[model samples]
Target: MTRLYSQPPRIDAGLFFLRFTGCLLLLHVHGLPKIFHFSEELTHIEDPFGLGPWVSLLSAIVAEVICPLFILVGAFTRLACLPIIAVLLVAMLFVHPDWSIAEGQFGWLLLIIFTTLAIAGPGRWRVGASQSREVRYGAG
Candidate 1:
């Protein structure tokens, strides 16, 4: 008979799927465009905190581009999610507070995904998978 329980491998696979899909969607839709069209992105970049457009864009690039890259590889996965969560919160809650749920669904969904990953860690099947266990469960 086939088992229908969450085995370690199955859980790890699920985590990988979540990380891969979330990071891929974030990178392809938001991150890469920032790099490929830096000039255009700069013109309309939001400066919600009055940090200046350059600082805002660079911050977004780091959270959206660089951090996602780190999470994708499972390097500092939990730490990487913090910046993304912060950026998403700022964008959804502060920058575009007027956006209804329908309009901000994407950002909200990304928030949920990253938050889950942050709590769950990258799971096995990641680079330095064993180390991930140590970090999550504590070094022995």
Candidate 2:
């Protein structure tokens, strides 16, 4: 009898795909609606932190639409997570702090995942990879 050995799967690819897909989904489900609607009701209402509606809406647009798009494309993935993390923190602290887990936990979970991606980055397979190579080798 011969024993065969297989190497463990690399998690980087899975992580990259998960983060990319998750960010895209979030942008579509949450970000796009807010951006497209741009209602006074949503924006005029004072932010949870009392930052006022305009600031809140602007921040939300930057985090949900702009930053998430960068994250999905793996362009500056780590840097892009900063605004998202900020938004999530604001939500957790002011918006949904008392909400039951069943009522709303996805935002919190996304915050954690985005934080993790910030630390791990977009992995080797990312737009950043090519940019990094170009920087290192000089422009073609």
Candidate 3:
């Protein structure tokens, strides 16, 4: 019996798509709005860490914006995912505790994707620091 396709490459591509799509949407759709409204939200945002609203706002911006951008580029992808995951978790539990499963579906999906990337490693495509660590297996 012969398989129809090489599995590893397909799996790697799927992982890349998952990582890129999640991070890109979160960065532009969510993070950018927060950043652009930082001053207005600073005193009003939730502070789950007891660090005050301004600090929380900044931390959230870093997690949602900076960290996701790093993950999108595959630079320290695993490490970058940690902050993103943390932000999502806090949002799930505290900021939006009333969020129904349907409403929080995307958040849950991102949590799973980030967790997967954290474990599966950042696949074969990358730039900057992680480029050296990426390994490709070609059937020669």
Candidate 2 residues 1-140, lDDT tens each? 44443322366577777777779777887788887788844745448767778888888889989998888778888999999999888777777778887666788788878999999777666664642332133243
Going through the candidates in order, what is the number of backbone clashes in each?
Answer: 0, 0, 0
**Residue 5 local lDDT, model 1:** 36
Rank by lDDT (best first): 1, 3, 2
lDDT of 1 at 116: 100
Model 3 residue pairs with clashes: none
The residue-level lDDT of candidate 1 at 46 comes to 92
Score each candidate by Cα lDDT.
0.91, 0.77, 0.82
lDDT by residue (30-114, candidate 1, tens digit) is 9999999999999999999998999999999999999998998889999999999999999998999999999999999999999
User: What TM-score number comes out for model 2?
Assistant: 0.77
> What's the candidate order when arranged by decreasing TM-score?
1, 3, 2
lDDT over C-alpha atoms for residue 132 of model 1: 28
Single out the weakest 10-residue window by summed lDDT for candidate 1.
131-140
Error of 3 at 82 (Å): 0.6
